[model samples]
Target: MTTFRESLARVASRRSFLAVSGLIATAMCRPALAQDAGTPSASGWAMTDGRGNTISLPTRPERVVAFSPVAAALWELGVRPVGVFGPFRQEDGSPDPQIGEVDLDAVVSIGDWEEFDLERLIALDPDLLVGLSLPDVPNTLWYVPEDASATVEAIVPTFGVTPSDRGHLGLIEDIESLAAALAADLDAPGIVATRNEFTAAEAELRDLLAEAEGLTALVISASPDEIYVANPSWFGDLRFFLAAGLPIIEPETEERWEILSWEQAAKYQADLILVDNRGGGVPFPVLDPIGTWQSLPAVQAGQVGPWHAVAPYGRRAFSNIVRELTEIIRQTDASVVA
Candidate 1:
């Protein structure tokens, strides 16, 4: 995942806003509305997380707190919870906010690292507490003293980040697993419709990339320290590389992201550079400095631009991200003569 050397800041302007709700929130475009108590799922030990964390839940849990964004996929899959660790805008410039839009009023706030109030979490009386099994960096990282990983397993029934090999996995896997927990199938009409839209958008991106001269592209952030770019493995806009038949610039590395310098970045025979706005690659703002350098030929040619971060697996905005990424690819690729 991308790491920001400097403190991360959210851009306030609409120039960097993109969302595609799956119509699940026709009720949410407004303000708060009371929702009836959600029905619970059956009794049993459901599944295991990425790190092999197993949860033996007695009954469908009514109170739930997700420590990872991928867990949002659970809500879409019919696993509604009382709390969520979501992507939110902090009011006081704190690394994380106390609570954001993810909470449905009925849900109590069980925050992430910056705002993890273990006391409040215990008071909330959660029947099931789920956590990310892996230390996928910013996605989910909690301190476990010695053998912290094992300690976490002992404390709460933590699960791993979204699975990678599963076709329905990635960020989206959260929805399916969550559905099983909530006893609600979210993929029927609303989720399925959004998925179809994304499929079409991805197809368009592939057609545009394949038909046009393959632009040798480099991935970077606004800053030098951050340069982990995405391919098919990392979801979000990067999916286009695979769906569009575009070739990726793969470097030898086992980590989620790698830091690359301008000279090294310049060496890439790519026609474009797509910045990872998510924490997985380079922090978003750092892309500005890296993109405007006159010494670099790609910047001079205006082949550098930022890809807005979106949960490729998010149930609320997955389709929206696809549309935005497609537009970027189309507009950016327009400069290249076929």
Candidate 2:
């Protein structure tokens, strides 16, 4: 598995090349139409994606190969995908936390990060390939290598859901709608219960935030050399938090992240610090030796928590995050930064 830093570097390099070579225009040559409501037709099931590509199959797709996060979201609604790709597994051979409660033993892993096993994916005989669409990259599926995207799409109908510029709740609703189109019972007791739990969690978080006046948080991913401050507007979870009355520090950048040197780590004084907890990031403990990091107010006050920027999108997954964040806010001292 590639480290998060390494993966970001690779993506940056590829994106730069794509920009220079005018491949973005070529990628947008695919069919574009208005978004559909994933309605079922007499001939088959037809659904449009975030990229405005409607995929029609002879029947409702039964064999689905999806990105790990997408699979995890569908799993919560009782839709079991046949195969999963992307960062679904960790280097230790354990299921990645981003996958939520997926049964790894039951599904085939088609690939990891930017690499895919074309042969294994083809063998799955998937009727649909689902993944998040990169907002900055036209028609590009997240985690699907740009070089192999054509080959992969040629094998099956592809569905993309974009996560950027929307709140997490909105994204969850989109996934729920997709699950319904896949024939999952939206009124299932488990699904309904989880939705109710998520609603309650949201309320609790809002109430807690109301009391923690002036409290602010900074979201970041750390590497050995630099700190990446996430742009809240580009992240569903952070956008959701901001909309829910949490004062998340928004970096001054159009890109998804603001890169900063170690010395500039204190550029934002936040009452609480949320460090990225994904497999690709360096753990917070590993930064204890860095004097600049240690000097941060939140770090000195011990008001730091883990941030799951790319966790599986669903009621259950998000509810857990909200509840955990509520507790962290409850324990944090709002005066830490001041």
Candidate 3:
């Protein structure tokens, strides 16, 4: 059995952006004739959002503005938005990578995660605004500031799909239901094929982990100042692995994450470590100055990898994530890590 670090080294050499794009294109190239691609002529439609609020639309929401991850999911469902509330341009002025391969050249930038351009959003005159929400925090938009929620919702009916509350499969199903109401083909061959692939990949992951009964992993967000260990209950991604029977060690403290001072991070050990990979996340190298971090076995052995904390919850994305982790587990040496 090879150590987790050695497995990762091999995995990195095999990753290919072009190959992934090809896969996504091949798996998700939706038909232009999709009903959801056209303006909805129906008089009205209704559905419940993440907040459990019944929202009635005068017609299918063709002109939409959504959070980045939600926007990506909508694209997979064959729906495009008028604007997205994420960085429109990267630092180099390229299209934001947050939305995956979705074309955003024509999509208005409502604003980034912290603040929204209320004037720009209103000018778009969107039919709907979408994002992730939690039932516990009703009325408030998840990433959007509370000060702007009322004004934003006033312009367009807001709907949210809470992934954390719904779990992985439920989240996909909810998005499917929303897409159906919007006239997207939930049974489209492309979508059906991706779903089938995701199911098979998930099963394979479970079987692979079953063979490594003692293998364990940890999810963390590291920064120059602190380390945050994710609790499975708080993250849909971590929860997915936990449900698959993977040994994901939870933080001892009874919160969504157990925060540790940078120097204290090495005390917790696991066979593998998944560090947050979003643009804002601090890279693993940031911990180099700390002796404790250097001593951590996972880090010393290079058993760390990027975790897409806010990946789109769609069939293709889920399938890819599961497959990647399955390969890592298969390559990892249980004895070395143990």
- Give Cα-based local distance difference scores for all models: 0.45, 0.77, 0.66
Clashing pairs in 2: 4-280
| Tens-place lDDT digits, model 3, residues 210-319 | 88867878887666666777666655666678889888888897555677887788657887888766553337566678777777777777777767665665677777
Q: Write the per-residue lDDT of candidate 1 for residues 49-134, one digit (tens) a residue.
A: 44444455766566766654444556545555665544333434332211222434555555533555565655666666654332
Q: By the TM-score metric, which is better: model 1 or model 3?
A: 3
Could you estimate the TM-score for every candidate? 0.68, 0.89, 0.82
Clashes of each: 22, 1, 1
TM-score of 2: 0.89
The parts of candidate 3 lying over 4 Å away from their true place are 1-43, 94-97, 280-282
Q: Candidate 2's error at 4, in angstroms?
A: 4.1
Model 1, stretches more than 4 Å misplaced? 1-3, 6-45, 91-101, 104-106, 135-156, 166-171, 222-240, 252-258, 279-292, 308-312, 334-338
Worst 10 residues of 3 by lDDT: 18-27
Q: Give stretches of model 2 more than 4 Å off.
A: 7-41, 280-282
